[model samples]
Target: MSITVYPARRILTMNPSQPEATHIAVDGDRVLAVGEVDTMPRGDGCVWDERFADKVIMPGFVEGHSHALEGAMWDYLYLGYFPRHDADGKQWSGLKSVEQVQERLREHAACLPAGEPLIAWGFDPVYFEGTRLTRRELDEAVCDRPLVVMHASFHVMTVNTPMLERAGILDGPRVEGIMCDEQGIPSGELQEMAAMFVVFDALGHNLFEKVSSPHVLRRYGAIAAAAGVTTITDLYNPMSDEAIDAMVEVTRSVDYPVRLVPAMGVLQWSAEEGIARLQAALPRSHERLHFGLAKLMTDGSIQGYTARLKWPGYHDGHANGLWNAAPEVLTELVQAYHQAGLQLHIHTNGDEAVELMLDAIDQALTLWPRADHRHTLQHCQVIDHAQLRRAARLGVCLNMFANHLYYWGDIHYQRTLGPSRCQRLEPLASARRLSIPVAIHSDAPVTPLGPLFTAWCAVNRRTASGRQLGEHEAVSVGEALEMITLGAAWTLGLDDKIGSLDVGKYADMAVLDQDPLQVAPAELRDIKVHATVLGGRVHGGD
Candidate 1:
């Protein structure tokens, strides 16, 4: 048997029994023991690796609500408001105004052949004051070719005239999300699924829906390695045969950098088919791809005006938002999946959506009576004290999009929920106060994929405008770290296998330049991740 020992400056195991350590012993991919170097009780032919001796080691981050597409999207044009670095270490500057967005699109469109379909993502009009990007503005950049831009939230799409002409939605029926002007012309602004599908069908790219291309997993892995994440979720995959085959191959490979837990999208298949499809893949399941969970997108994004919020709706009084499934149908779906023994992680950004989710899961559990359901409500953003208590009672975990405070906090404070409700937006403290198991996430590509940044946002609760979004909701740095580690693992239902560093668990570690607990909360996002150790195999080390 092969054995290796890694010595670090300090090890934050996240294991309550032996929380701190200086050395970790690995037997193949699993941890054999963790303790100090001089006193490590080891026998025979064990290799001692001290490369990380100068760096602090913590349990590898467990990101519960990110998509693999964050990696794949880099191949396309990036127009995100926040500066992002691709897997290749190429940094793209953030776009502030529509003028800069148009300039960037024009420059990128100049190189592409005509009619090639200039596709760009990470565009949001929420940050701007006066006017948002419309089809008219997009036409100025590339008139002849079909230009389709996906909003940063993925809930809205802005397409040029060519796109509308190709899709035949220009004169088509008055869809719910399609905007028409005084002249009765379609405004080229499509919101939510009903309208976005028109553009999706024309473009023929599954950028938003069912993106499981192999390149996605590669880039996602690269990003994970850089951020010191060991296991990540492709939270809402469509589970096509091609995608599953690719996932199986890549995950089964011994050198796969990060582990993946892809929840099959319920919308992609019938309830029976969804269960059977995953059941079919169950025999082939490995340590890397744990197919224990499935995803159900309850509603849309708040900033995109698609989230289903209650009472006084949007500050602008737009609309209530779209429900992917009715309460009864959602209840039936959850019941079927829960009865079949698959964990369901529903996407609910709004409190009303959360209410529907609470009802659905409650009905399912009441009917099936299964314990340890760990059915998570992903991006449970606008939750309240009562909802947190109800969630705890129902045994439903909350994987909050804590990054919302930074990504859309200012806008939400000023526009959507206004100050009173906005200040209470992701009640992390309320969840903890109620003794509910809560894990924080980036929901990457929605926000970026850095857990430290997610934790920083949780600890600081500061928005881009430097306003304290919810001082009452702020958590301590240690608690925030737990949210990213074991708490996240529990939300994913992989707590027993991964999460904390322990004997018999996989030896995954994130080597950091500085200790997160010792550093100021503001500097948490600034602290660099030197390398990641997955299953005792070192990746991204100098």
Candidate 2:
């Protein structure tokens, strides 16, 4: 065996019985052994790759749930989402008021091409106080150019006169979601799925063709490698077979440091056709490329104020949210995929959606019981104790949207669910108690994929205001680390081959500037990755 040794100050294998190791030996793509550095096995043919004498080595992070298309979209965008002062920066990402948005848009419109649509993202009106931008304000922002600023939640949008005229919104059989006043004039805000679709389709955002390019894939891969992530579960848009083909082609063309597990979209397929499609795609299923997790979106986000709730609705009492799939429809779909031996990773951010999905899974399991089924619920932002029990009983895995506590935790506490319900968001401790395997995700573009930041959220449960929402729900740094590392691997059904620095496992490891477990929880976000090793080869070293 052509072996190599990696020695570090501390190596976190994440193996339960023996969690920490100082040395790791690799034989090509697989780990040969892990143990104390001094006592590590030595041989005549072995090569040593010692690194980061003051740094920590851990298994590369695995994203249990994420939208790779969205990641690629951000890669293709001008990336003015985060305000970094630049003359060319045309983003209105975190504008505080309607006036600020107007000023920014007015400036951007002056420099844009005449006919090209001025597309802007990351506009959450909730954080901008109760002020909702109207069509007049958008029209004032850009006089004649088509302008559509999407709400960060992706459920709501604000369109200008040009877009409204182009979409034929002027005189259509009143769509299901275009919010309007008593006079029937199109309000600035488009709420729910119906109106969201009109604007999205009208924007001509061909997600697959727009985002799936060699440039985008390489950029995204570089981002992942920089953050010490070696594998990602791309919660895919099922309708885009072309995107899938492009992703496969890209991974093959380059020595990708990160492995991709693409959870194919199942929303477009019937129970029968879905099975046929999955069977057709099985030949693509292998170690580093294809996976069998079927993705289903069951509801919108909490930030959108469209998340289905249990009791008194939102604190503001605006809307009670919408469901992505009817309970009966979801039940039939889950049953078909379950019976076909495909793992289901459903996106549910609302308690009502969680309850609805649990019921579907319960019914499906009753019809076809399988202990190792490993069905998953992605972004389980609002699961309660009862629902947690149901998930445990149904053998469903919970991919907790831990990033919510950072991005939307404040809004959830103050506006979305109120302080009481927000306190129970992402019940990780409860999940652990119920013996349900839980993993955390970045949801990226939605939030950046920083495993350290994800660990900080899980460990501190603190919001932007520095207030701890669910201190009891906080996990140990080790446990939080595991959620992104080993736990995430298990969530992706790649535990047998990845997730830990154990023998026979892939040599996917990360070198950190410091040991996260030893650092203060508050300093977790400041942790930087020094280097990454994937399949026994270094991706890039600092």
- What would the TM-scores of all predictions be? 0.97, 0.93
Q: After superposition, how far is residue 160 of candidate 1 from its true place, in Å?
A: 0.8
Name the lDDT of candidate 1.
0.86
lDDT tens string, model 2, 1-542? Answer: 67788778999998886799888888889888889877676779787876566779899988777656544555222222344221222442556567777888777777777877887666777776757777888887786778877666666778887888778786765666677867988876777656666766777774434445656666667778888999876775553566566667777744777887877667666778777876776676555676567887777888887778888888877778776667678777878888888888888888888888888888878888888888889887878898999888878899998989977788888887888887788999889988899999888656666778888899988887778888788888888888998888888888988888888898998889988887887898899899888888787775
In order, candidate lDDTs are 0.86, 0.77
Query: What clash count goes with each model?
Result: 0, 1
In model 2, what is the error at residue 76, expressed in angstroms?
A: 6.7
lDDT of 2 at 132: 71
In the predicted model 1, the residue pairs found to clash are none
Can you write out model 1's per-residue Cα lDDT over 1-542, one digit (the tens) per residue? 76888888899989999989999888888988888878665667788887999899998999999988787777779888888887688889999888899999999998998669888999988888768778899998879899988888888889999899988988766667887878989888888776887677777876755356666787788788789899999988878888788888888877888999988888767899999997887776788888767898878999988899978788877778887766677778888999999889999998889988898888888888988888999887788777888898998899999999988999998888899897688899888988889999998888889999999999999998899988989999989999999999998888888888899999888999999989988999998999998998889879
Model 1's TM-score against the true structure: 0.97
